[model samples]
Target: MSKTYTNSSTKFSFALRLIVVYLLQLFIKAFDYSFGGVFPLTFRGMIFTFTFVTYWLTIWYASEYIQKKISHLNTISIVTINVLIGIYCGLSSTVIYMLGDTYLFQNGDLWEEIPFYNPELSVALCIIYLLIFTVYAYVQKIFQLKEKEVNVEQLEKEMFKSQYIALKAQIEPHFLFNSLSVLSSIVHTDQNLASEFIIKLSKTLRYIIEQNKRVLVSLEEELKVVEDYFFLLKTRFGEAIQLQNDIDPNVIETIMIPPASIQVLVENAVKHNKLSQKKPLCITIALKENLIIVTNNYDKKEAEEISTGMGLSNINKRYQLIAGKNIIIEKNQDTFKVSLPALSTIDHENFNH
Candidate 1:
């Protein structure tokens, strides 16, 4: 909620800044003509000034809206569309103002020196205003693009921060305590096996630490971490936990995902499900139809693990931020599955820079 509010405030601030600049330009334009002494300071003069201000404001807003809506188009398309819109808005506002001036104030003491009553001058001024509107809109568009890029960079930073916290939580005391307990028993039984466990444990910890500097990792890189993680889990649980890897080698090399996403899903499965010698917890990792899928058989624990859902939630949020995709999660009586979009090399490259 607070983040949303901040984003809204930033947008409002940008718009208000543009409006202030626009009003100053309008004041300067009005002053240019008023200094000639043709324009007066009476009630009729005030109404004329207000009408002109309204006409300019209408063109400004219409150009702004059209520019934003078609920002994806080439520069030529944007300029052409904005030009047409500005002319239309300018003409419409000028005609409306002319109608009000001609019908509503026909009986008033009008000065011939004032161009407000001249349709020719009104049209000419509207054309000039349209040209100014174009330039102002173009400048605002450039500034808005810069601001959007900055916002995207900020969002990426926040995503990395969330991922760091999530990864750090995975290696904290509670998780280490379990691994250490398993290591302690193995060290006593088989020194050689314990040595292998120590190596795998260190590798897993190393991966988590390395991710502190990374927002995204290649699928193959992520799989290496998941493999090390599975090794530890298998060593600890023996035949009580089963994991299957069914990913295509080609897809693994061409796609990317948020670091530690698979690890989080595997840990989620381990944490939530029952595991026993007779009823092993089964988890599968696969790639299909441009998606990275992780699924597990349902064996929900009698006492659910204490959770804030930070891992999966962060992974979901990060995917939304980086890839503009959502992670799919489905569960039924027999299975729980998560599917994430596998971004292609081209898309991944674009996303990074």
Candidate 2:
């Protein structure tokens, strides 16, 4: 905090604490006088102020310290400890306060004691405060438990996703068959182009393999794989599949993204959409402010189970888990769009290790 804010906050807290203790003292001393009598406006009123303030601060701080120490104890044990702390703090402070009133201010006169020797009721104030603190501690622990659950769930998801993507890339039979089949035909006509296709396909597989261990990757790094992946697809589909990207070079260097995120979206479009000479599938990737936008023509293939939306749901979960951000999806009759938050350097710093 800034110095000015700290000073102001301290003053405010002191004033508020004084007000609370003053009201508490008034409530405690109310029964001493009859209905028509005025409230204490003399020096003894200062003694009343000191009484509640002393008990309040002592029991509050003591309960806080000891409750934290015994947090692992069961409910019944915790309650027993709290009751002991309250009686100790409340009775000890009240007795000392009474003794001080008799000796220091009243010259050891028993009749001039500040309070009328009712320590038991005064102790109830400490018990009430202990109850409040116990409830607070339980609520705080619940939140901590929830946070741990989220961290564990995210770890499990990352593990499953890495294995799923890596295994699918390595074992998907159709992808290899089509690549090699395309290569066989092209190698007969142009050896150089066929070799380039083979190299790009190899890089595509290598990138997926290497990136399985990562939760996040640089935009430039992921974009290189996207380009290679696109080349492999273009080799097989020819002019039927097209990609349009207009990302800033500087943005790509400074930003981070989930590895293979763009590639997955492109592949998803090609998988469930019709791509032919009649109406080609066009996918566009662009940057709009802090969002990386990917949109494709909404042309579903004649297969119901293919549009299950599991792929998009997984992307949403990964974004939320890693960056604490969400990807926005928009779809209509002709186009489907997903706007992903472009993670910056500071954003990546927040990721779980």
Candidate 3:
């Protein structure tokens, strides 16, 4: 048999609340007796107190049942049902009290002194039920807020980890080797152009370093990095690799995205596809329907590239954390395209700093 672990915290809370309600009932009874100018610890008083505690516990159980069943109910229906439950609890408490007085105490005058049905007692019980429900609701709200805070913290940590991993991948030994080889080839042929290429490569590296400290960057800033990266690519491959850019000026300043997103997409295109004079690789960047679309021809090399495929996966995870959106990837026989979310400046500021 499987052993079931009971929720100790829930049981402790219920016990504490029961003690509080019992003390509150005693206080109210004492207040009433003060007016009568008599207070005594009689057997009748002990029995009455016990009955009251039992009555409140019944209402507590009923409230739990209502909460479990009526979650999907509309506001009006839930309120109506809860009100009826309170009325029933009030009526039941009065019956339990009268029965204790008549049978347990053996008091013949109970019928004459305290009537079988007391409207005032029922109303008072209903009010108590409402107060109890209100307190329960407030406590539940506090728990929900705490849970949400924990979830947000976990997500922020995951986002930062993804970004760090992507940076490591971009700055690995193989990438540095290729870039240095390109720079070495141009040094003898065109010294001025080689100088410009070195500057562009430096600028691209500087941007990556700066952006690693931030969760998001403006589209305009990201575009500058992309331009520098493309300049290096164009210098290295010359006419073999071409970038076709058509970006809207208005969207650049207003929209934001995770740092180095466009560069990763462009680098992915270059890495997977073959580039030569006969079959030039042409990559396109454009804006469409509130998204930044980056596409390239699907001319995959015969051998598969050695990669963990974390480029797009990391970008997608970061987008979800920053904008609560998804990156759309589409592939056909000849084209591969990815559409990224274009977040507003306000949305960018709303993320965890």
Candidate 4:
């Protein structure tokens, strides 16, 4: 469908260009018979023809060039520009016509013989033709601008679709099953703890559901959800998993980051590394040099239990679409780190939807 539309648009544009090219010739031919026997088909007549067509094409495209540069278009501005071009084109065309006849054609005394040789009539015709051509140029510019807007909207829609798929991928079945299995075992022995577990589990699920709700979120809001997710993880893993948050409190309310970024990083770290009381998988989140840094100790597990491998990739995509920024990743034998650009509060409204 898009191809068909593009082909049709190309055909229309080609046909329109041909018509514009011939319109000036038509205008020149329309006045050719006015000279009759007084001005024959000679070098002088061809000179007038060249002058009219050249001047017409020059002003016509010049108006379009102006249209492209004017960021804001309105009736008054268009009218002002059109009137100026019309006057310039009309006065200059009349002078060119008179000069060509008086000097080149040696027909200065024949203006009375030629009915269409009146200067007022010549100027009026020039202004009228210019008005028509300039108006067409203005409308063509408007359509091009509208086409650009449509393309941008289509691009945004595609980005949002990717965001939805990424959000869905954040929910892990293994995490859910393991959390539920742990919950069932402790409900009787630790009723109070079980209740707390249920609450954190609900919050974790709710956080997943609310992903992609907005393009940007405050650090405070994102950390609260991350805390809920961490609570569930710690409750299940006991001393085997630990998270240390050292984000600057002063900027928590003022700085923004992509949603689910910290949670995804923490989840990714736990999935890829070994975790036990002997060597705990320690995850740290901190604000350093205007960056939200997530780091985890390296402990190679012979085999990872579950990894869709989309966690970090999805975070990178969301950050790009939301803030036009890229997340930085650095890893060595001892540690894996991801650095997310900290956004400002003033720009939150720019990415809300």
Top candidate when judged by TM-score against the true structure: 1
**lDDT value, candidate 1, whole model:** 0.73
Runs off by more than 4 Å, candidate 3: 1-148
lDDT of each: 0.73, 0.73, 0.78, 0.73
Per-residue error at 314 for model 2, in Å? 1.5
Model 3 per-residue lDDT tens digits across residues 275-346: 997899999999988899999999988897587868888888777756668999999989999999888878
Error of 3 at 300 (Å): 0.9
Candidate 3 local lDDT, residue 140: 64
Question: Which one wins by lDDT: 2 or 3?
Answer: 3
Q: Write the per-residue lDDT of candidate 2 for residues 13-42, one digit (tens) a residue.
A: 456546665665566567545212336666
RMSD of 3: 9.6
User: Better model by TM-score, 1 or 4?
Assistant: 1
> Candidate 1: deviation at residue 215, Å?
1.5
lDDT of candidate 1 over 1-353, digit per residue (tens): 43575587567756764565456445534644533334565665666657656555555666567667897999888767756664565466555655655577673233344444355544555566556656665665775676557657765676677657656667678888989999999898999989988898888888776774555778999998888889899988999999998987776876888778898889889989999999999999998888899999988888975888777777877777676689999999999999988876765565555
